[model samples]
Every structure is written in structure tokens, then in C-alpha cells.
Target: MDAAGLALVLATLRLSTPLGVAAMGELVGQRAGVLNIGIEGLMLVGAFGAFAVGVATGSVLLATGAAVGLGCLLAAIFAWFVLNQRADPIVTGTAVNLLALGGTGSAYRLLFPPERPIVSPPAVPDLVPGVGVFLLVAVLLVVAVAILLSRTRIGLEIRATGERAEAAHNEGIPVMRLRWACTLFGGACAGLAGAILVLWISQSFVEGMTAGRGFIALSLVLFGGYRPARIVAGALLFGGANALQFQLQAAGFEIPYALLLMTPYVLTLIVLALYAGRAHAPGDLARPFVART
Candidate 1:
């Protein structure tokens, strides 16, 4: 392959890693009966947190830790509203998105005062050669998560909470606790995904940087039937489409840049149309789980 082709292939892997991680995380959350539409907001917080911490401390590891924490914080807040208070998941999720949008924008202003230069953080160090390592890691994470959700005791409780909270509650499964834990864990993963993308790959956390990646990941969860490996495939497919768009641009195709930007969304719509409803969601996705007296 030519240099550009090689670059495109490498870039594809890097771009897909974050989505894969985020999707896997969401798969876990949704499996446990929590629907977090605020992944976009959580991701943005993680991205910005990584950038800010990385720049201040000059430590990528610290940055990643901060990213995970921030993601969990956002997730915890969402859990409070949806799981505990019985708020509408979609409405609360949208609020999370708005919070992230404004918070990041405000953070930038504070970080870069009028006289200071706008500085991006140093790049995140790669664990192995090239971006392929992240892709490989994404694969491993999917497998690990699938095993956790399907094989372990804690996993069983998690599934129990989602599939039937009242029965699980009577069975002493601590349904609310399980939901909160899974939601927090999932959010942390989402945050780490965004952090890796911004600090290691994109090297910048510009406003609205996550764009619709969180939404895409959410859709992948539905399309993949909440299976970890299948979710990875869906993410890779979306990532592959994104990669191809750049390739088409480099190939001197006469398509408008705007059209290239639309490719991912178009694919999302297509996938939703063909694959949605085919995938089975947990028995109680948006239902308020209440313990029977």
C-alpha cells in the first residue's frame, strides 16, 4: 500500500479504539438497566480532563486517571437522577450533554486567560507500536467485558437487575447498588476512551470534540444486541466508514467535504433501519425499577 494508504489504515485503528471502548462500556451499562444518553457529555469531560491534567502535570497516566474519574462522576450523577430519583433518562441525558458543552467551553476560557497562549497538551505515549495497539486493546476489552457480564457472580446480579429488578431485589441482589456500580464503571470506560482519543490520537480537546461519537456508540449498543464482540464489530464498521471517507478525499474524488462528513451519520441511519429491533434489549430498558413491598 502507498504511504497515504498506510496512514489511513493506521488512522482507522486509532479512530476506532475510542468508539470501541465507549460502545463496550455502554453495552455494560445498558445491560444492567441504565440508559446513559449523556455519554457525549461524559466523553467531553474526559477529553478535557485528560488534556488539562496532562498539560499541568506532564503525565499522561495521571491524565488518564483523571479522565476515568471524571467519566464516573458524570455517570454517578446520571445514576442519581435516573436510577434513584426516577427522572427521565433521555431528558437527564440531554441535560448532561448541555452541561458538558458549557463546562468545557468555560474551562477553556479559564485555562487560557486573555494573555496566555492556547496550548494543547503533550501527546499520550503509546504502549506499543503505532495505533494498532489501541485497536487490539479494544478487542481485548470487548472480550473481557463480555466474560464479566456473562460469567461472573457480580455480572449475574447486574444482568438480574436489568432483566428483572423486583425479583432480584427480593433475592437480595442489591439492585440499586448494582445499577449504580455498573453505570459508574461504564462511564469511566467511556471517559477513558475519550481521553485516549484526545490526548493520544487527536491531541486536542476542542469544543464539541466528541461530536456524535457518544450517540453512535449508543446506537451500536442497540444494533449489536448488547453483545460485547458484536458491539466491537459495529464500532469497527463505523470506524471503517470514517476511514474510507478520508481515503476518498485523498484519492482526489470530487465529493464535497461536507458530504464526507455526513457519511458516518448516513451509515448510522442505515444501520438503525436495517439492524434495529433485530437486536434484543434488556427486558426493562427505560422502566423504573421498584422493589415490591
Candidate 2:
């Protein structure tokens, strides 16, 4: 491939890294019968946590650790409310997003005063000559999740829970426990996704740096039919669209940049229109499991 082609490929991989990571997590949650839209919030706070830690400690590992812990922490709160309190997942997810937005914005202002220049944090060093380390991490994670969900006993139970919670419970599977574990795992993925975004892609915590990638990842869950390999493909497609937009703008395209910026979302809508109702989703997806007396 020519230099330009190689550059485009690298850019697409970089852009896809975070989306793929987060979507894998979402795929796990969905397979375990939980629908969490708060992934956006999780990613947002995760970005903040990574940025703060990287700035304070100058350690990429520490930053990523902080991001993952924060993501899991927030996901635990959301799960407690949804699974334990019987709250609506959609409403709870929305509230989580709103809270992250407000909290991150406030924290950013306090840490990065308007009078000072915004500085990008130290990035995690590249793993290869031309590719990003996080992209490699994402690929490994996708493979790991695929194996976990397809070739393990826990995988079987998770699938059973998503397919029929009542049956799984009657068969002695711990339905609520499985869901909680899946939710927490998903949150950790989102946290890692946030780390990839700030430490690798942007290298700074812009308020709302996630930029709807969480929603896009949610769509990828459906777009890929809730499969890890397909989710990674969907993420790559969306990432390519985003990269193409930037490339075109750099090449001085005459079209409005706003329209270019909408490429990924527009493609998402188009794909959904084409494939809606065709994918096989988990039977118990998005339905809270209430124990019967």
C-alpha cells in the first residue's frame, strides 16, 4: 500500500480501538441479559480519570488503572439500582450520562482553568512501528471475549441467562450474579476504552471527549448481532468513516465539514435501516429478571 493508504489504515485502526473495546464490553452485557446505555457515561468518566491520573502521576499504567476502576465503580452503582432496586435501565443509563457530563465538565474547569492552555497528557507509547498499542490491545481483547463467550462454562451460563433467565435460574444458574458480573466487566471495558481515547487518540481530556462513541458502541452491539467479531467489524466501519471525514477535510474538500462529521452516524442509520429486525438478539435482552416468590 502507498503511504496515504497506510496512513488511512492506521488512522482507522486508531479510531476503531476505543469503539471496539467498549462494544465488546457491551456485547458481554447484552449476552448476559443487561442493556446498559450508561456506557457513554462510563467512558466519559473514564476519560476524566485517565487524564487526571496521567497528568498527576505521568504514568500511563496508573492512568489506565484509575480509568478502569472508576468505570467499574460507576457500573456497579448503575447495576445496583437496576438489578437490586428494579429501576429502568434506560432511565438509569440516561441519568448516568447526564451525571458524567456535568461532573466531568465541572472537574475539567477546576483542574484546567480557562486561563491556562490545554495540554495533552503523556501518551502510552506505541507498540509497533506504525500501529498503536491500544489497537493491539483491542484486538487481543476481542479475541479473548470471543473465546470466553463461546468456549467456556461461564459462557454457557451467560448465554443461558440471556436466552432464558427463568430457565437458567431453574437449572441452578445464578442469574442475577451472572448479570452483575457481566455488567461490571462491561464497565471495565468502557473504562479501558476511555483510556485509549485520551491517552492514545486525543491525549487530553476534552469535556465530553467520548463524543457519542458510547452510543455508537451500543448500536454496534445490535449491528454486529451481539457477536464480538462482528462488533469489531462494525467499529472498524464507523472508525473508517470518521477517519475519511478528517482526511477529506485535510485534503480541502468543498463540502461542509458538518456533513462530513455526520458520516459515521449517517452510516449507522443507513445500516440500521437496511438490517433492522434481521439480527438475532438475546431473548431476555434488556428485561430485568425479577425473582418470583
Candidate 3:
């Protein structure tokens, strides 16, 4: 590829990293029959945590850990509601999104007011001078998740749980325990994704910085038909759409800025409209499991 083409490719990969990571986690949860729309909330909290910790300690490692920790905490709360209380996953997730939005905004204002915005928080160290460490991590996660879903006994049980939780439970699989584990895993992944966004991509935090990427990650799961390879491809497509607007503006294209900003979301809608119905979701997804006496 030429220089411009290479730059676009790199930017696409960088942009896709967060989505890919989050989507992989979501896939795992869905495979275990859990649906977490709270991924957006998890990511938002994670970004804020990473930013806050990074600013306080000036340590990227600490910030990343804080992000994951926060994500797990939030996900645990979510699991209690949906998994234990049998709340509606969609409604609970919407609540999570709202909570994160309001909570993060309030925290940001209280901690760093308009008079003093956050500046130069610690950044994730790169593996190579120009390439980010998380990018490699994202790629490895893809391979790992693919193998995890296809190769292991745990993978079979997870698939069985999603396909038929009752059957899996009857077969002696710990249905509730497995679901709990998957939900927490999803939360950790969402947090890591948030860390990548702040430490590697933005190097700063803003309220609602996730900007619907969580929802987009959900779509990516469906778009990829719940498969890892296809999900990575979808992430690349969305990432390319995101990068295209910047490239066009840089190249002095005459397109309106607002329209450029809409490219990724518009593509998301188009893809969903085209393929959502064709994709098969887990049979028991989003259904709260209640043990029968």
C-alpha cells in the first residue's frame, strides 16, 4: 500500500481495536446465554476510571487495572439484577447506560471543573514506536476467543447453555455459575476496551466519550453472526468508515463535516437492516434462567 493507503489501514486497525475487543467479550456472554447492553456503561465507567487513576498515579498499568476493576464491579451489579432478580436485560442495560452517563458527567465536573480540564493523562506504552500494544492484544484475543469457542469442553458447555440452558443444566453443567463467569468476563473486556480508547487512542477522558460504540459493538456481534473472524471483519469495516471521514477532511474533500461524522453509524444501520434477520442468535439469549423445583 502507498503512504496514504497505509495510514488509512493503520488508522482503521487502531480504531477497530476497541470495538473488536468489546465485541469478542459480548460474543462470549451471548454464547453463554447472557445479553449485556450495559457494555456501553461498562466501557464508560472504565474510561473514566482509567483516566482518573492515570491522572492520579501517572501509571498506565494502574489505570488499565482500575478500568478493568471498575468494569467488573459494574458488571457484577448488572448480573445481580438480570441473573438473580430476573430483570429485563434490555431495560436494565438502558438503565446502566443512563447511570454511567450521568455518573461520569457528574464525577468529571466535580473532580475537574470547567476551569481545569484534564490534561496529558498517562498513555499506554506502545509495543513499537508507531504501533499500539493493545492492537496486538486485540488480534491475539480474536484468535484466542475463536479457539476458545471451538476447541474446548468449556466452549461446548457454553454453547449448550446458550442453545438450551435447561438441557445444559440437566447435563450437570453449572448454568448459573457459567453465566456469572461469562458476564464478568464480558465486563473485564469492556473495561479493557475503554482503557485502549483512553490510553492508546484519545489519551484523555470526556463524558460519553464512548459515543455509542458500545451499541455498535452489539451490532458487530450480530453482524459477524456471533463468529470471531467475521466479527473482526465487521470491526474493520466500521473502523474504516470511522477513519474515512478524517482522511477525507485531511485530503481536503468538500463533504460536509456532520455528514462525515455520520458515516460509521449510517453504515451500522445499513448493515443491520441488511443482515440482522438472517443472523441466528443463541436460542436462550437474554432469557433469565429460573430453576424449576
Give per-model TM-scores.
0.95, 0.97, 0.97
Cα lDDT tens digits for candidate 3, 232-267? 999999898888778989999999988887777888
Task: Kindly list the per-residue Cα lDDT of model 2 for residues 51-115, writing each as its tens digit.
Answer: 99999899989999999999999999999999999899999999989988999899999888989
Which regions of candidate 1 are displaced past 4 Å? Answer: 113-115
Residue range 1-293, candidate 1, lDDT tens digits: 98887777777777778988998888888878888999989898999899989888887778888999999998899999999899999999999999988998899778866698767776765666675345656777888898899899988888888888788888999888888888898888889887877776887778889989999999989888888878878887888788888888888999988888988888899999998969878888777787777
- Candidate 3, residue 137: the lDDT equals 87
**Alpha carbon lDDT of each predicted model:** 0.84, 0.90, 0.91
Residue pairs in collision within model 2: none
Worst 10 residues of 1 by lDDT: 125-134
Give the C-alpha lDDT of model 2. Answer: 0.90
Query: Model 3, which residues run further than 4 Å from truth?
Result: none
Give the clash total for candidate 2. Answer: 0
Question: lDDT of candidate 1?
Answer: 0.84
Local lDDT at 188 for model 2: 98
